[model samples]
Structure formats: C-alpha cells, structure tokens
Target: MEFRILGPVQVYDECTGVLIVPSGAKQRALLGALVVKAGQVVPAERLVDELWGQCPPTNAANALQAHVARLRRLLPCGEPGSGRPHHEWLVTRPLGYALRLGDADTDAGRFRRLAAHGRELARDDPGAAAGVLRQALALWQGPALQGSGQGTICAAEAALLEENRLVALETLYDASLLAGHCHEVTGELEELVVAHPLRERFYELLMTALHRCGRQAEALGTYDRARRRLAHDLGIEPGPALRSRMESVLRRQDPAGAAEGAARAVAGPATGTGPVDEARTADDAVAGAVSVRMLGEELARLRGHVDRLTREHRELAGRLDRLTSSPVAGPRDLAS
Candidate 1:
C-alpha cells in the first residue's frame, strides 16, 4: 500500500492494482491534511476547520465522521475476495485520527529521503548525485494536491511540498553542471527562471550555466534581470548567496565555484546528523572549495588563451583582406 500526496491525495493498492482516491472535494481536503502530517493524530476539530473553514456547520463533527467512514471504505484492502478491512491503515486515536505508514510508504517521504541521499553524494560524485536527484524529482506528478480545494492547512502543505520539489530540481541542475552538462541543462534552467522569477537560486543556476557555456555576457545580463525583478517585486536585494554569485560572474571567476557552493547550500549542517558526520561534512566543504579555486584558475587561463587566438585570427583576416583587395597584385607581380 502506498499513500501519495505529492500530486493528489491517493492510495495505490499493490494487491489490487487500483487507485483509491476520495471523490468529493472536502473529503480530498481532509485526506490531504491528514496525510501531510501522517502518523500524527489530526484532531476532529482541526479536520472540521479544514473542511468548512470558519463557517463549519453545527454538525461539522458528525459530518467529518461521515467523511472518515466513507474514506475508510474507499481504501483498498487485501486480495479481492478475502473480506479484509482497509481500516488498518487508519487508526482512531484519543486525540483524533492517524494514518499509519511505513517509512517509505508515502511518495513525499521517499522524495525527501532520495533528495537527502543525493545531496550527501553530491560533493564526492556529481554524476551519481544527478542520477539520484533525478529519481527524487520523478516522484512529483504535478503540483501537490492540485485538485483539492482551498483550506489553509491544505494550501500551506502544498506550498511546502512544491518548494521542496523546486529545491531538489535546482540541486539536480547543480549536479549536471558539475558533471559537465551545462549546455544540456540551460534550456530547463531558463524555463525554471521564467516560471519562478522570484526564486534567486534558479537565477543563480541559470547564470552559472550560461557562464560555463562561454556566454558570460548573457550570464551577467541574467544577474541584472534578477536584481531588477527582486527589487521591483520584493523591494529587496538578492540574498547573500545570489549576490555572491553575481560578483563571481562579474569577476569571470570559475563557474565551477557555483557548483561547490550549491553542494554546501543543500547539504549544510543538517541537525541530528552528529559530530563525527559534521566533521566529515566540513572536510568535504573544504575539499570542494579547493576544487573550485583550482578549476577557476584553469578556466581563467583557458579563457585568456581563447581570447588571444581570437584576436590573432581577426588580425590575420584583416591582413588577408587588404592583400586580396590590393589590385590583383598577383598578375602584375608575376609579370614583373
């Protein structure tokens, strides 16, 4: 059995290969609220509030009980004819009701775990991180609880989940850049920036990608756009991370520096991961910093070499053009 709320509130039955989702909007809202905080008892009062807002009927509690009963019946159980009850997944607690689920039973839970694992692997192995992050992103079908109608609880949960999805996507783009696939991800990053103009991280990723592809001018232009948008919409400057990136691009520093920073940003000092792990994490950050500095130096040298070659090519072209235009000197000189 898998409970999925990443897109819509749904239950997939492995035994029967059927999807059990509540049909009524309010019922879906109630289910979404409970599933978002699965394993915790959602008080009947809270459910009533989510279903009817402040205008709940006098019999809201009774109405909620009816909805829960229907939802329980709708959940799929064991083998078709086994007469098993699906109510095992939903437990009645003294505080309220709780939805029981294993650690990996929910798509949202699995997505978080996968994303965490991907972030952990990013500093050491970018290719593997990209692959894992891809898997994590694949879990999102659409906006979380898309059809579920508005309730503050439901809306807030949806927003939080979507934000997580975007962060994971940005991390994936970072991994792709570190794996030397900036050209391939530029289009996706562009779309993300358009979709989320207020998101500084996406803009930062886009700028880094553009810079890596030798479009430093466009990359700098992206920073200008980000700055203008942030100032206009939020009446604020870009955050420290984004401002730092803009400075790096302006200085024509290593594009790989952005990737290292991304690694630290996503994987930084997660609480409860312990002292030994913290020390290891610090070591990794240092290693990533060193790698960024070395790569920046190499990129600077290469850019200089390319610039020289381009200048020489243009000078040679100018001389050739002058000689060619100089009055068919070939015939006159040959005759002499």
Candidate 2:
C-alpha cells in the first residue's frame, strides 16, 4: 500500500490497484495529521484539537475513535495471505495512536528522498541532478492536501510541502542551466519571476538565462524591474548575488562562461578588434574573473551552511526519535 498526501489523502493498494480514501473532512484531517508525523504517537487531545479546533464537542474522544476505526477498515492490510489486520498500520498506544509506515510509503516521504538524492548528485553531475529533480517534481498532483480542511496542523503541512516543491523547482532550473539549457528554461523562468517577483534568486536566474540567450537588453531590463520591486516592497537593495548578476549583465560578462568563449571565437584575438573594443574586452575579462572568484567564495559559504543545516536536521531527528520511543502521559492520563 502507498499513501499519497502530496494532494488529498489517498491510499493505493499495490495488489489490486484500488484507491482507499477516508470519508468526511474530519477523518481525512485525522489521517493527514498522523501521516504528516508518521510513526509517532499523536495524543488523543492533539488529534481532537486538529479535528475540531478549540471548540471540540464533549464526545470528541469517542468521535475520534470512530474515525480511526473507519479509516482502519479502509486502509490496506499486509500481504494477501498474511493474518495481519489492516488496523495494524494504525497502532494503538497507551498515550494515543501511531501510523506506522516504511520509507517511500508516502508521496511526501518519497519527494524528500528524491530531492536529497538530486542535491547530492548536483555537485558532480548537473544532468543527473535535473533528471532526479524532474522525477521528484512529477510526484506532486496539485496543491498539497487540497481537500484537507483548514486546521492549524493541516495548514502548516501544506505550507511546508509547497515550500519544498518550490525549492525543488529552483534546484531543477539551476541544474538545467548548468547542463546548457538556458534558452529552454527562459520561458519558465519568466513565469517564475512574475509569480515570485520578490525572490531575488529567481530574478538573478532569469537574468542569466536571458543574457545567455543573447537578449542582453532584456536581461538588464529584468534586473532594473527586480531592483525597483525589491526597494518598493522590502525597502532594501538586492543581495550580493543579484547585484553581481546585474553588473555582469551590464559588462557583457558571462556568468556561466559559455558566452565568453563564444565571444572570443567570433571576435578572433584582442589585437584584431580595434583599440576601443580591445580595451572593453580587457575590462570585461578582468570583471568576469573577479565575479567568478566572488561566486566561488559565495558557493563555499553556501555549502558550509548546507552542511550545518544537515547536521542540525540529523540532531533534531534523533531527538524526535528518542521522544517518540518512550511513552508520555496524555490528557486522559493527567485527568486520572
């Protein structure tokens, strides 16, 4: 059985190709809450809060139990001949309930895994990175948990999934550009910049794509628009990366090195071009070298940040595992 929570909550039976979806808004919300934090015990009170907000009915616990039981009947059991009950997937604990699942059992989990693989491969092989990221992106059906109602937990999960999807798209575009597909991505980058005008990185990328496609004037125009938007909306200038891209565009310097080589081939030697052209070429070369050095330094800094974040994530996961491994008192336990 595979669970899909990238959009609505759905369970697919591998053996029979049947979809088992929980009925009602509350039941789906309940399933979403458990699946988002899969393998952890969610206290009854927490489930109740997610299902009905602060104004839960007096019989919320009984209502929750009914939903869980209904969901169990709809979920898939283990292998065909196995005596295990479908309810085994939804384990009951003294504190509350845990939705046990293996890796790659849920679309969200699968997306994370594929994205991580793509990132790891991106530094070595951009072509492979683009492929992996494309596969990761193919998993999303629509807005995450679209039918899932507006509860605090549901909203938070949806936001997180959307953010991840955007990040994956950005990564895919970066890899595509590196693989010499700048012209191919220009239209998509245009749409992305319009949708996310405040995102300096997207503007920087769009500018690079335009410049590479020999649309230098349009690239400069894009930078001007982004600069104005940043100032008007955030009251701040663009960051170093975006500013460097703008300068590179104005100087006719290639951020990715291809255009520079092409220019050299077309212009022959520095001596053949007139004095003014030679001087301009010399200045562009110096600026390009400096920009490349700055970009290298910035990349190193970002890599360090990625490493630190990876460590922090691992530590947090370890702490969460420890917390969930041991049972804790719930609201009912406190009441008794």
Candidate 3:
C-alpha cells in the first residue's frame, strides 16, 4: 500500500491498483495527522483537539471514534493470506490510535530519501543529482496535505513539507548550474528570483548564470534589482555571497589596460643602459604595485566565498537537525 501525504491524504493499494480516499474533510484531516505521525500512538484527546479544534462536540471522544471506525472501513486490507485485518493498519493502543504502516510507502518519505540521496550526489555528480532531485520534486502533485483543512498538526506539517520542497528546488538549480547548464537554467533562475525575491541565493545563482552567458550588463542589473529588493523588503544589503558575485562580474569587465599592466608587471623591467631604462623601471614598479593590489582583491573575494559557504553550510546543518528531531510533542505529553 502507498499512503501519500505529499499532496493529499490518499492511500493506494499496490496489489489491487485501487485508490482509497477518505469520504470527508475531517476524515482526510484525521488521516493526514495520523500519516504524519505514523508509528506513534496519538492520544484520543489530542486527536479531538486536532479534528475539531476549540469547537469540539460535547461527545468529542465518541465522535472521534466514529470517524476512526469509518476511516478504517475505507482503508485497504492486508495481504490476501496474511490473515491481517484491514483495521490493523489503524491500531488502537491503550493511549490512543496509531497508523501502523509496516511495509507501506509514503510519498513524503520517498521525497526526503531521494532528496538526501540527491544532495549526497551533488558533491560528486551534479548531473546525476539534478536527475534524482527532479524525480523527487515530481512526486509532489500539489500543495501538501491538500484538503486536510487547517488543523494545527496538519498545518504545521504541511508548512514543513512545503519548505522541504523549496529547498529541493534550490538544490536542483544549484546542481543544474554546477553541471554547466547555466545558459539553460538562466530563464528558470530568473523566474525563481521573481517568485522568491527574498531568497538571495537565487539572485546570486541568476547573476552567475547571466555573467557566464556573457550577459554582463544584465548580471549587474540583476545585482541592482536584488540590492533594491533586499533594502526595500528587509532594510538590509545583499549578503556576502551575492555581493561577491557582483564584484566578480565587475572584475570580469575590467579594461584591457589592467590585464596589460599585470602582464608587464610579471615580465619585469627591460634590460637597458639609458634614461629610458630608468623610466621603464619606475613604470614596472607602479605596474607591480597594481598587480599586488589586484592579487589582494582576488584573495579577499575568495575569502568572502569561503565565509559565505561556511555560513550556508552551518545554516543547512541546523535546518537538518531541526528536521530530524521530533517535530511535535507526543500525544500523551500534549494532553498533560
């Protein structure tokens, strides 16, 4: 069986090829809550609070039980000869109910697994990572837990799922760029920047794509737009990574005189025996100074890149820690 919560609360029987859908909104919400907390017993009282919020019926427990019974009927049965009851999927514990998905798969689970795999591949084979991430993203049919209403647990889980989806998208673009598909992803990155204007990383990637495609002017323009958006929205400047990208673009457009001076500086003073030799020596010193300054600037840019990457790595690690930790209080704990 496949219990999918990436888009909607749905269960599909792989053996019979039949889809089992809940009959009502509350029922769907119940399934969503259980699926998100599958393998754990959710206290009856917590379930009541999730189902009806502060407006639960006087006999809320009875109502919850009734709903659970009806939902069980709609679920798929176990393997034909296993002698397992269909209701075994929805087990009744001493505390409350638990959705025991022994061998079933959930789309959300598959997405997370594939996304992790893709991220691992990103460090080695970005092209392959892009393909895996695309497959992970394709699993989403629509907004997560759609039709599950706005119950607290469902709402929180849905938001987390949506966040995971966006992160996957960012990784996908990153992989695409690393695979040297900058020209192809430029348009998509532009759309992403417009859609998520606050995401500075998208702007950074877009700038790089444009610059690599020889659209230096457009890249600078993108930087300007990103700077404006950051200032207007958050009363701040672009982050280090974005600023570094703009600096790179500017450096790329430096006049040929700069390169010629650096070259001359490396070639050193010409051997001669006249006033011209002295003048050339002085010129070489000035050019050599310019070369040193340019080297310092390049070193600073590289440092900024390192700092930005370190910050991003820390941030991603923190997010991963939060995601792996228990997201919510246990049902018994919630009741207390």
lDDT of each: 0.80, 0.81, 0.83
Lowest summed lDDT across 10 adjacent residues in model 3 is found at: 253-262
Candidate 3 lDDT over 1-336, as tens digits, reads 889988878998877688888979999999999999999999998888888998999999889999999998888666567555544789888889999888888999999999999999998999999999999999998999999989888999999999999899889988998999998999999998998999998998899888778776688789879877886889667888987887777655333334454565567646544444544555455445544664576467568868989999999887666655857756664444
Q: 50, model 1: CA deviation in Å? A: 1.0
TM-score of each: 0.71, 0.74, 0.73
Pairs in steric clash, model 2 = none
lDDT of 1 by residue, 1-336 (tens): 787888878888776677887898987987888788788988888888888987998888788888888887786544456565434667788778877775328888899999999999888999999999999999988889877778877899899888889889988999999999999999999999999999999999999899889776678678779877986898666788986776676565433444545565566646766555555555455545644674575467558868989999999888777777777768554454
Q: Order of all candidates by TM-score, from best down to worst?
A: 2, 3, 1
Select the stronger candidate by TM-score from 1 and 3. 3
Please give the RMSD to the true structure for each candidate, in Å: 21.0, 14.4, 13.8
Candidate 1 vs candidate 2: the TM-score winner is 2
* Residue 279 lDDT, candidate 1, scale 0-100: 56
lDDT of prediction 2: 0.81
What TM-score does structure 2 among the candidates reach? 0.74
Regions of candidate 2 where Cα sits further than 4 Å from its true position: 78-87, 102-104, 253-336
Model 2: per-residue Cα lDDT over 58-137, one tens digit each: 89889889888988877765655755443478888988888988532888989999999999988899999999999999
